[model samples]
Structure formats: C-alpha cells, structure tokens
Target: MTSDRDWTGRVGDIWATEWRRTDRSFERLAPVLNAAIVAAAGPQAGTIVDIGCGAGATSLASAQALPDGQVIGIDLSPKLIAVANHRAGSLGNVAFRCADVASAVGMHAPVDLYVSRHGVMFFADPVAAFAQLDEAAAPGAALVFSCFAERAANRWAVETVAGADDASGPTGAMTAPGPLPLPIRPMSRRC
Candidate 1:
C-alpha cells in the first residue's frame, strides 16, 4: 500500500486476507441482510451504483432482486473489485469501478440509485463527495446502504468471538463535522 493513498483504497490489502479466509460466517448473514434491504427499498429501484462494494455482496443482491435494473459496484480496491467480478460473472447489467468514489462521479454518468455497503463515510472532503453523489443520482433516486451504526461494532463483534490483539482503541464514534451549512439527515434518514 502506498503511504500517500487513503486507507479505503487499501482495504483489501488490509482486510481481504482475513475476511477471505472467514468460513461461512459472512455467507450466513447474506440472506438475512438482503431480504431486509430489498424489501425496504421496494420493487421500483432502478439502476444502482454500489459504493465501497467490497466483494460485491450487496451489489449482487441488488441485481438479483431487481432483475430489470442494473447494478454497478464501485470501490478503490482492485483486489476486492476483482474478487467481486470473478464471483458475480456476467450477470447482465452489473459493473465494478476501481476508482476513488470521491472523484469518480465526475467521470461516470448518473444512475437511478447510489447504493453503498458501509461505504461513503470515509472521505476527507465529504461535502464534495456528497455533492458529487447528489449530482450523480437521478431525480428522486434512492440510496440503499447498510453501514455500521458504529465503525467498531464489527471489530468488537470479532473481538468478542475471537480474542483480539492487545492494541485496540476504545469504541468511539467515527464522524466528522459537516462542511456544508445545510443540515444532514444524520444518516438515519435520507439527506
């Protein structure tokens, strides 16, 4: 990993080895998550752009559920993108982009939905990032993302299940003050 690039881009190198080896634990959670999210979004969601779509789990689910719509998973990690592509194969109307989401919207055309799985939260300039995504989404586009209410929740879960290295920080909130003066919907509701 380059010292200059952001950690989000290097997530695969940092976590892939560990997660890829994970038995069926993640697989078991897939169906449970897919049903809840797909049902909540309803059946009308059009094209979806899955941001930070590690391994394409959510992306695949969206595509499977919305056969009429397309899904494009975007992430900064080449390895993760590759894995996602390899696993999904030619499921018509599905793509993956290995570019930084912060600047990628400018290069790509807009879509009907901007989805993310624990993505879109780690940006140095969220205002710019949100604006980019805001512009990229089609009018009335819905964003379906499943993120940790707390970043350390997953880590803590793993720690509880399997002993962790001694060097762990206390559970803390991971957020930044907004750059724009406008009110954000606290990620609980659409902005």
Candidate 2:
C-alpha cells in the first residue's frame, strides 16, 4: 500500500502502498488524531508547523484551531502534499509542502510553535534532524514531541509481534514513535 509517506495527492488515500491497515485506520481515526493534535496545540493562536503533515489531517486541524495563525505541514510525499493543497484551496492559512522535514525547516521562517507527531522518530539520524528543527524556532518557542522511553520499558510489542522489527529501517526500529493506545475489545471472562 502507498502511504502519506509516499504521498501523491489523492483524497481518501494517504499511504496507498505502505500498510493498507494503517490507511484503513487513518481514515477512521483522522478526526481523533486531529483532536489530539488540536488539544496539544492549545488555542492554536500562532504559527504551527507539523513536520510530517500527512495528507493535511493535522494541518487542517491546526488551521481550524489557529484561525488567526498559519499551519505549515511538511512531508516528503508529493502525493500527500498535493492532496493537502488541493483540499486546502483558498484557505490561505494552511500550506502543505512536498518537502523533507529538514528542507522545510531550513526554508520555513521561525514560528511560534513547532509540533510534530510520529514523524520525528523515523529520522535516519535523530540528533541531527532534531538539531535542524531546534534552529527553526523563535525565542521562548515551545517544542513538544513524544518519544519512546526504552525497549525494556515496553515489551508488549516485542511479545506480540515477533520479528516485526517495529521501528527498524537502516539503523533500527526499537525506537518508539509513541506508545499508541489501541482500543480494547472487552472480554467476557466472568462478572
């Protein structure tokens, strides 16, 4: 399946060739993800930068939350960015770019707040990538991101998806993006 990661700009499809399951979940869970991001933005009264804007789900949410401000969602997927821009026609406050996170940081002006969800964790080099983002902030600006604690701290994954290589790329996959909370299916063991 394709993905927002490989974006090409088609509505109703973000990550088309990646994990089909993720695409399925993405459509259904977009609003919830938007809500979470919107809540974190907290009033959204300033420039909001979403590193992996991902088909504008978060970017659109940011635009709504920060009506007075602008939201720039940057990603490497042209398809995804195109879809975001097409959907964002004439909005004037939200801009989605088909650019790498680092490239966007270099070109984008310093902003009030910089926000990223699961994007940062996939960096080929986290320290270097973060340093670039760190440079793109104004004084007193806030940088918030959630990263994994440690493998030892969370093993439910290790036990459940053996050999899944959860975070591995060229370096490794043990890194945590965030401990995503799955909706549980209640069991009827006894009352």
Candidate 3:
C-alpha cells in the first residue's frame, strides 16, 4: 500500500509532466476564472492561500486583484512551481511553493481567505487536509473552490477521452463555517 506522501508525490509528478505540455491552455482560462473568484470573494486585504495553484496563474491573479494582500500558491510539483515563480517575477505580493498542501508545514496562519481551484479533490485524506486548512483560516475567513461534477455531468470530456471515466468522485464538505451543517442546503420548512 502506498503512503499518503508516496501517493501525493506520484500525483504531483504526473501533473508536473502533464502541465508542462498543457499549462498554457489552462493559463488562457485564468483571466475569466480569476475574475469570477475575485468577484465572489471580494477584494482580500490580508493573506490568501491558493491550493494546488499550478503555474501560479490563480495566485498571480489574486495578487494582482488584491494589491494589499499577499498570495501564497502551494503545489506539489517543483517543476510547475518553478514555472509559476518565473511567471510571478517582480510580483511583490505573490509567491509560489512546491509542497504538498495535505502535509505541508509553515502555512501562513490566520489566512484571510483560502481558495482552491479544483485542488482539494486530490487529497488522500480530504477530511484531515481540510481540518488543517480550517485551523489555518482565521475566524469567519472565507473558503471558495470549484471541482468537476460527476462523470455523467461531464459527458463531453468522457466522450472525448474515448469513454474512459476519470472517476472523479465528490468529497463532500469536510467542514463548514461556524456551526452550520455541511453543504448548508435549503430546507423545505424551518428547523
């Protein structure tokens, strides 16, 4: 059985190789995606943590969006992080680190905002990882992320990949703000 570190290392290697060839395509989407995230999270004034920030596109965007804030983009691929750092040249408010967020140490604590661009889904232990994130976030800090939907919901990609399912399953909410129940769905009647 592979340990968490081993598993994450392998995953990182795979992404590093894949992103080296395709990172540019994702960079093209950063503007729109970053705009939406900045709009939703509003302008951050403190620190923002960008989990799995490949090539630092989102992190650079966050830094640009929040001039007063510091952005830290963490990923497990040193090669990708290198590219991210190169791309972030002269960006005083932004930095990228090559480390696995699931077990990464020295996270900037009391983070004002924690943003993940399709990052959390790859955690070997989602609950534990989020627990660490929850501890890192300040009280009332905002958390925002986007993940791919179910396989059936992404038929185009499935068909394009020759009917091979990537098996991207949902991890559900690991924790919620305050005492709110996970998901925070609407109720038919008042509780």
Candidate 4:
C-alpha cells in the first residue's frame, strides 16, 4: 500500500517530474473517462472535485468542458499540485490544492461531481474516504473514476514496473487493497 508520506515526499516528486509521461500513458483511457465525467456532470454542474488529481489534466479538461462549472483538483502531493497550478495557467474555472481529498472534500462541500483517473487506488481506507465524499456531495452529485483492470490485463503497467518492488516484497506487483482483477467492484454500487 502507498502511504500518505510517500505521496508527500519521494513518490510525489517522481510523479510531478514524470507527469507528462504519466499523462501520455493514460491517453487512451483519459478521453473515455473524461467523456463519462462530462456526461455525468452535465452542463449545470456547479462544482466538481478531481480527487487525487496528479498533473490536473482531468481537472483542466473538465473545466474546459464545463466553463460554467468550477473544478477543484485535490492531491496529497505539493509537487503535483504545483505542476497542476502551472499547467492551469489562466484557466478561470479550475484550481489545484495539495491536500487529502477525504478530509478536504468538506471544504468544497456540496460538490456536484467527483472524478478521478486511477487515483483512488492509493487510499488506505477507501470505504471511509468515499463515505466522506458522499457526505460532502450535493443531493444529486455524481462520482466517476477509473482504476486498472488487473495485473494481467494491463501488460503495459506490468512491463513498466517489471523489476520494481516495494516494501511488500519483490513481485513487481502493485499492492493496492481490494479485488485482484477489478478494484472498481467496491465502488460500483449506486447510492
């Protein structure tokens, strides 16, 4: 499991540095995910939160898609937040913040939509984290996110980290909690 400390420090720095590559890696999935988010949010969505927004690509895209809506990208990495802010430039509808979305969601209360791209996988306690988001959301708020299919399904990811290993052991496998083939199962239900 990736800890908050990792995101706040070395891991975060690496992501910030390699954000361009990371974004490119998600090129195929991003459009599909963004389209789902836009469809869920609709044009009248007043406020949207991009949970675990790394370099703000999703946030920027959503902001551009919904010019009348406000989009806030929240992440645990200061470096990532910096990159996001820099990329945002003069976009009036989007903003980035370095903070835990579980705790910070309340700050942007009544959010009309919540979106992520393989971001929620790192949460230590996803159930509790999502509960908080539920609490802070508007009556008809929509949540949309995407996570990796599985170790086998995503050959690109496995190949990319073929030799990498963390404290868990030397399997070169990701240690995120939940189902092996599909992590989305936990959050699949409608409220």
Best-performing candidate as measured by lDDT: 4
Show where candidate 4 strays beyond 4 Å. Answer: 152-191
lDDT by residue for model 3 (2-80), tens: 2335434675566566765555666666666677657645655687888888777678888888888888999777767
TM-score of each: 0.70, 0.64, 0.71, 0.85
Clashes in model 3: which pairs? Answer: none
- Measured with C-alpha atoms, the lDDT of residue 44 in candidate 2 is 44
Q: Enumerate clash totals for all models, in the order shown.
A: 0, 20, 0, 0
* Location of the lowest summed lDDT over 10 successive residues in candidate 3: 182-191
Give residue 64's error in model 1 in angstroms.
1.5
Per residue, candidate 1 scores C-alpha lDDT tens digits across 1-191 of 12215433454666444546532456766676667657645677666787777678788888888887778888777777778888788798688888777577655555667777556655556678788888776666666665444433456644653565654633344345211212235444342
Model 3: how far residue 145 lies from native, Å: 1.8
Residue 112, model 3: lDDT of 75
Give the per-residue lDDT of model 2 (tens digit) for 109-128: 67666666556555655567
lDDT per residue as tens, model 4, 89-126: 99999999999999999999989999998787778777
TM-score sort, best first? 4, 3, 1, 2
Q: lDDT of each prediction vs. the true structure?
A: 0.64, 0.60, 0.67, 0.85
Name the lDDT value of residue 32 in candidate 3: 67
Candidate 1 regions exceeding 4 Å error are 1-10, 14-29, 106-108, 151-191
Q: What's the distance in Å from true for residue 128, model 2?
A: 1.1
